[model samples]
Target: MNDKLTRFLFEDRAVRGEVVQLQGSYQSVLESYHYPKPIAQLLGELMAAASLLTATLKFKGEVSLQIQSEGAVKYAVINGTHDQRLRGVARWDEGLQELPTEFSSLFKKGVLAITLAPKDKERYQGVVALDKDSLAACLENYFLQSEQLLTKVYLATSLDSAPKAAGMLLQIVPPTSETYQGGDNKDFEHLAMFADTTKSNELLELNPEVLIHRLFNEEDIRLFETQDVLFECDCSKARSAQALQNVAKTELLTMIDEDGDIKMDCQFCHQQYVFDAVDIENIHNDNFDAFNSDGRIDERTLKH
Candidate 1:
């Protein structure tokens, strides 16, 4: 199944919205990683929320919505590109509960940090205390405090759908010069309060058109063309080699001597990059780029 992300604009007022649904796309991320129920659910929610956030960005780059904590579940992160390509993973302690219903049960005390990075521009980050009852609530507050604009986010996921993570967001766009408030922003305030009543079922199960219509029937809404979202990870052995260059030759050579190989992993996709003695020598030697263990480097790949 193809993944879908849609954005909507309100014709009558200064507000916008987005709705996303993942079916096969969500399940695909789960195939290689075996996560506990709570982590899986956390990943699903993060994936859905990230997709919505990525679409709402007014710039050209991507957004990383990371959830880190000091409790048993130390970290849970989801990174999503502006093109809708998403990939993420989590780390946690064992003997945890198999089933988790409340969002707080996953992490006793965590912080949701959001960093906005554009390809050719400066990066900006905002931190939100996980003091709220739910992740969505915390993000809503983040929008209010950071942007000073009203925003609401709703996300949901299920394994029964086998790999789909879907979610929706509704927010008021800051007023344009022409629409600047004079006395009171009664209309914008009403819209934001209305969005607070959005149900999880509507966010998870409804079609984009039907969902928005149900929520904003009194206002005129404009829908944008839908875009495709993908589960793509930008990782390669060459990129791995670049990172290795920063390590000391003596240390890497010693690791190879002990384990007979140098192995590395990509935290985002959990991809393993293994390098043996010959591989380690190449990195330290002058001809690091010229030598390759037989059949190790795929010859046809393009460099990043």
Candidate 2:
């Protein structure tokens, strides 16, 4: 299978970039929920955007890209670690849109939040309202405001026969060493403008080398090897059990009384975990992980 995401350095300049193409991974996230088409596309874009954002930061822990609103789109978020493990989910109101709609339609009005957490250090968060037309533009505004750098991003998604979502980032890094060779800010600007001319199809279909040459043929360029972006969710039954422990005992009993069994499902991967009265009581009594029904996870519950 073709690798889903790849990070590359220009080598000539301080700018570094990444390209993410998602098909199976994107589709798996979409399959987790029956969201509207607009929401699906938004989730795809957000996932790709999150991957690109994580690449920018040489982080050792977690980074989450979240867009929350009280309007049509309640929440759309993607989480990734430094290892490039990614998962995303989106929630929206009724009414299915046949195709990808505008960002305003998906998130009527809301703020974007980016939280970066390092394992042994304090977590950092940045928030900004959706004053721009697209999520891509919103993120670009975020980069300019938070990092105080001139950054540009090109995001494209094709809803055609072969759905592919791709994105690119261009950022200028100030030289830090005594033997520093300064970058021409004006040249970076021109290069970004040229990158802005890229099309969605070209991003999705064309080979990376071809695409780079098409965008920056005039400039000396180098491309790195690709990394796979696989369809994987980190949700598990153990985590669900931990959640059960967190819920109040009264609420757990009420859920069992009302619904026969409490069925909790993970939004990221849509995996369901069902619990009965005995299970709830055990959760309340013991802080242990979990045990199967029939009071046995060993030979007693064994099948004939």
Candidate 3:
């Protein structure tokens, strides 16, 4: 099935939920690299989680889920935008033969960082230790510690032939009244119980509507319009050029002199951007004016 993210609200209870199923997008991410089974599955789950979290953004921006560790899996991150475009990449230690399935074993001392970068505002970030066995639990802990909201996350992935990922999120809406005594606990608990029972296979195989209906048939659910999610890397030659501008001009020139050209590869999409001597000269002369004020390269100046 095509990738999609769906949001639903409980009319009778003060709660909100989101469900996302990823297939084509998940496969697109894995196609760029030959990841191990455990790492691939972890990346898929991170992608699904990033999509679900990105849907919750109230502004035009992107949300990134990053895990940094000192274990075999050094770094893994997934980026998702408000529009649902997603991309991810991971790096691991060389000469590592076996990767453990547990989070603690994979990341002996790691931190899970969630960053929210808005298009027109300051960015916000939160970090939590990866003490839990599962990414879902670690994210839940993040919500509890950072937002102080009762949140539950369920993530699943299938790394077989056709890779896929699915995730569900439920958060309790805070009480508006000052005198309201936390009566929504029971309601949130009731819904979370059902969501927890979701099976990995079911989540990967079933559609959003069917899955929701099967899980929360008794609740009055207001399903919103589905949003399409796809794997799209935002990297471009212009961005790469701008990055080159950040380096010392002498360094870039030296690289061009030694290698005949400077080649930069995007880790997420594996797209290579090559900068020849002429391109480097243009970048230095124009002082990056080859790019417009909007940060996009001018069509006339682009060579590749």
Candidate 3 vs. true structure, TM-score: 0.92
Q: Report the C-alpha lDDT of model 1 over 89-163, residue by residue, as the tens digit.
A: 777876665545677765666889999989779999999887777777888888877766667787776666455
Candidate 3 residue-wise lDDT at 21: 93
Model 2, 164-226: lDDT tens per residue? 678888877656523322334776777788888988888777877778888888776667767
List the candidates ranked by lDDT, beginning with the highest: 3, 1, 2
The TM-scores of all predictions, comma-separated, are: 0.84, 0.83, 0.92
Q: How displaced is residue 62 in candidate 1, in Å?
A: 1.8
Global lDDT scores for all candidate models: 0.74, 0.72, 0.85
RMSD of 2: 6.3
Give one digit per residue, the lDDT tens place, for model 3 in 1-304. 8999999999999789999999999998988889998899889999999998998888999899999999988999998999999999888876787888876788968999999999978999999999888999999888877777789899999877788899999987666523333334888899988998899898888888899999999999999999999999877777778766666778777887887888777888878778887777767775555544246431112222
Which 10 consecutive residues of model 3 have the lowest summed lDDT?
Answer: 295-304
User: CA shift at 58, candidate 3, in angstroms?
Assistant: 0.7
The top-ranked prediction according to TM-score is 3
lDDT of 1: 0.74
Worst 10 residues of 1 by lDDT: 295-304
Cα miss at 258, model 1 (Å)?
A: 4.2
User: Best candidate per lDDT, number?
Assistant: 3
